[model samples]
Target: MDVWKLNLRHLRSVAMTVRLGNLKAVAKKINLSQPAVTQSIIKIEEWFGAQFFVRHPSGMHPTEFANVLSPRIEMALNLIGSNRVTSTQARAFLSLSKTGSYVAASRDIGISQPSLHRNVADLQSVLNFKLVEPRGRGIALTPKGISVARKFLLARLQLEAGFSEIYALLGKETGHISIGAMPLSRASLLPSVLVAFQKRHPHITISVVEGGHGELIEPVRDGHLDIIIGAIREHPIGKDLIQIPLFTDQPVVIGRKDHPLTKVFEKNACCQNSQIMKLAHYPWYMPGKGAPINVVWRELFNRVPVDIPNIPIMGGSVMMIRQLLLETDGLTLLSPDQVAVELEADWLVQICTVPEWMQRDIGITYRTNWHPTRAQSYLLELLNHHSRK
Candidate 1:
């Protein structure tokens, strides 16, 4: 229908009449007589081959079609009014304009400037308006451009106010925090910390994910996780990352409570070669290779003066490993915390007579350069406080 033939004046008249609800008021506001205002509506209706108003004795009211046109007309008026502004000046009004070259919007939005400019062009086509123009050296907005900038400023103000409230609420512990944890630290350490945090800030939401060393730490480095509780080896700290030692774990050797080794070992005797062979026949449970506990076992086994392959039975869950230790004549390598329940019940007995070689260290690791949110910082403080006691 060649909609470009439609003028902003006609669109504004329609919108004002819809907004004001009667011809006399719209006429007074636009400094036009009542008949002139009525003619403008008639002209627009004829141009579009549609009815825009339904006349009555009390006043003139916009028809259903006129109601539909109001928002588009409002937008048209904005574009027409802001048509005289420079692109820089319009950006200042929109509050999203970048400094330096105009192309920087692509960087801010993570796209190229040409792409954003294309999007702006698409919007102008739909609105049937021109938003910006080049002066001698730089771009300027037409009167319609000024109008667009004013409407954009109003919207930006409302948006900024909403984000400010969200930021403030996050500071107040009203938002959610998700944490990832390594297996060794999950059960005993995290439960205590979570209980304390929930008591103090019941409004904050909390979630925890449990995984192994290789499975968990990358999310922290990529900014997907706020904090992580994983073990760090002494030598492998990566670039642009930091680590903090939380609490250390001492590894222990365990076996079925009634096994013969329970009665045979002296306080510090090396695990006997014959006795190791006897236990090796039973299902052996070991942590994954390269794990700190596994590394300790590798070192200790090499020094034993034996040529065994050093392979142990593999059970993934601590609970399952503990069950095997209780019901069968098997050996399981574990941290003390993994067997707390069994130790309390005497279902599993510590075979402490092994050479001092079996003891290993465990600790919590996290990114060093992370700038934690308020909830995250609060949780870390809770962890620190509890670890001390």
Candidate 2:
């Protein structure tokens, strides 16, 4: 018989009824009249040309055919849920994206005896439908139910393969990679790199987490995060921390175009004078607490200005800081590399390069003992290769 005529709804109904012990309960669960549930049972029996359920005063019960069809019902439900091993939904199903409870899956899928009862009861109510007549402790699939589930599984596999191929084109086909970065780098550079990586090796799956340098490093040490991109600070705690330099930053002093400091340049001038204090009066933008740049600035200046108390003035968003520089005379210190395009565009003019007293390095970092995934290794190789260029 052509199973194409059978539908998942019918299979689901049959699977649910078999698990719930009574048609009355199934009727209540599926929000259908008991008569409607009875009609489904009749139509299924007619299509299958088999007596699948044995009715009794206590409740309906499954026959020999029902026992044979149970496994097929399970496969069908799994296919729909993308739990068939290849669907993107499989990521959520396997508890990789998050956690999936055994009780929840058992109840929903009707693959286990106890869970099947509750799941069917719950599912029938939500779907407002019914399919199987329960018989004692056993359940059976109507012939149509078996046929429908098999068809669904086949179709699901084909659909999953199609999506798999698309992701494969982007390097997600063979491995997994986890990355750690700040929000700006995460939003800009990393996405571009991911797009490039995907084009080269389509089957790899990518994951990301964003946080501070010290906060992000621990994940790298435990083998959770594969690589991190940030300005170097303290080495990650423990002997296992490994790091590879991506690039270094050249420090620069930046101010709004109208700021007096922008026009006045005395090479090797210290920033701690009455004129400089007047310059600092123009709302200085700073990096956040504990950031390497902030720490260095505090140590060199030896005192935090009580004048600019707003924390938004100290943020990591390079673009926002640049925009503030364009619209206001907020002073900010930045890495020359990150500001190159702006400097070239004349949107910003460097007020000062670092005096010999201050400079810092920026680089891509990873744990020492950790090994990178193929995709991760590929990206690092590309970044390193391009840094030299």
Candidate 3:
């Protein structure tokens, strides 16, 4: 199932084969020829951009991706019950789910209630499942029907983007790109690049979402995000991701303008081991688990191979650290670029010298198999240019 070949049939076929564990059994159950089932499985592989099944002499087995996604997707598809659905039916089903009543849906769609009900009934017939239940003056989707609606809605969004991209490629207009912004990129690089990009491609809609690594990473894996950009880890990022290194942001210990350390550094202007060891005396602000800044903090300890004395505050809240440091003598390790505003205003001063090894690799990560369209490629190049500068 390449771009054009992807359809409900192929999706259902692969799902059934995974559940039944053999091509022959799946074909018999679905009443399709074995050769047809084989082609459907292949189509599913192409659509998913990965092989989801392993064929052996004994039987067929689901791959790891299949094992993970199969249950969730299967639950959704089971509501439809079969693969026979038209675009009109899909649209009506989707819209009906939203409006929740044939009268309201018909009014919104600018059609008669009878016509809307007929269309929904047609969809129900094609799916071989009852999708809605009337209660009071409105209706609600069944549990399985809600699952089906969710899957189709996701598919519709993908199709909308796909068609928009196709239109752009064919010299028509309209497109949308979803980009995930990580902590570092959100501060400067991503915003600067997006401004430049919007100037060039004004009609292409761009949506930017922000979160930490744990929150952002899985959305890209599930095809909900086009790309994620930020200060990245050098160690193994998951197998599903392809990270492109853009820049290196060094981590420096920073404190308030009038802190004791700033006064001491101003007089001495040196980062001797003795001065570094004195960091234990002052209050410390530690990075949270799994943050890129945490990695840089860990690198500091790994190189020095010693434990610091005081760690009263340990979390990843930027505002809290900024205020606490401004009011007290607490210290924190962070990428200089993240606080460029504070640095430029002289509100925050660097205390310890950042070592050469204490840098986070800033970059973009996308799904490994994703091939960008013209709009996406243009943004990627813009990011590349900004990161280099």
Candidate 4:
């Protein structure tokens, strides 16, 4: 189903009918005439090609389809937080927010510019709030408008999930899982899990976006991505996100196989503070400040009485880090699992392991209100299973 094409009022009426079990009560609650409510229900049923309610002398009895769809509809309505918002308004505003100009939005959605402007203006008037403001030649959504747009996007996702669930119950697997993958997961975790999941459920499409936490978190929160997998921050991530810890990973300081530190570490099996202090003399390749590994690297130097080494290069790309380590006399902190192949191939060597307390909690992060469909839930289970091993 094209969720953007759905009439918001009709969808709400269907959800209300499922809750109230009678057309009259649904009409009273939504401020529509009983006949209007009945027509709304009929239109939705016809569009969906399924009967949601079975009429009886007593009241309307919801069908299995209604049982599967109503909760999702209600959840979507709550996320949108307004009944006055028409589907056209939503479609227009979403396009404008994404494209950042009326002309672009109109071109993107195949709507006339004047009509798109009127629809957004009408929506703003109905909601009693300014949704967009002039930004140079383009436009930008106000903070409230951005919030509303995110809710609308998530609501659309909810409706899509409902149809996907219905299709699944009818023996057709149809849905997509979009994942935000951090560097560590891309290297050591996600490949195996994705392979196994695709082998089992080939009909369900999966896409992964690789990025660092800072780049991925906002998209996941705004429903652009389903979940993010990698190291969990030690600080609080706020109430809107839920973190599920998969495993603890101990990081080690690594350098090229023939680097000076490798010879020093080999001579002294036990790493003394002086031996650790020698790291301060070498240039470091590290992630940006405040990343988990960066924090550990700083603390490692703090334990000794040496100034933290200067990070000449700062990034989260393992490929870049590996190449830099081989080409320069530099060192980096990373999980051994992340560079297992390089270590085995004698390209890199672990100079020393960080303290147990510096071990990282690797996991998954998703929106707090996210409810996974059966297939998504199965994928999470597979991630947990593989991470454990």
In order, candidate lDDTs are: 0.61, 0.56, 0.73, 0.88
Top lDDT hit = 4
Which 10-residue window of candidate 1 scores lowest in summed lDDT?
Answer: 156-165
lDDT of 3 by residue, 203-284 (tens): 8888898777778887777567888888676778878789988988877788888888765665424455566666756887
lDDT of 3: 0.73
- Higher-scoring candidate on lDDT, 1 or 4: 4
Give the Å error, residue 324, model 3.
2.1
Report the Cα lDDT for residue 108, model 1: 53
- Candidate number achieving the greatest TM-score relative to the actual structure: 4
Instruction: Give the candidate order by descending lDDT.
Output: 4, 3, 1, 2
What's the CA error at residue 183 for candidate 2, in Å?
Answer: 6.3
Q: Which model is ahead, 1 or 3, in terms of TM-score?
A: 3
Write the residue-wise lDDT of candidate 2 on 1-389 in tens digits. Answer: 12324444444445557788588897887667778777777665565555557999888787654433434555546544422222222222222111134444454433563544454444334434442344454344445334333334344433233223323443345555668885435534566677788888675677878787767876665445667777766645456565566655556778655666755766435455343445545666777877877766555444434343333467777778889888877777776556668877878877765544456654676655343434456888776765564
Task: Report clash pairs, candidate 4.
Answer: none
Candidate 3: pairs in clash: 1-43
Model 2 ranges with Cα > 4 A deviation: 1-172, 183-199, 205-210, 218-224, 266-279, 303-312, 367-369
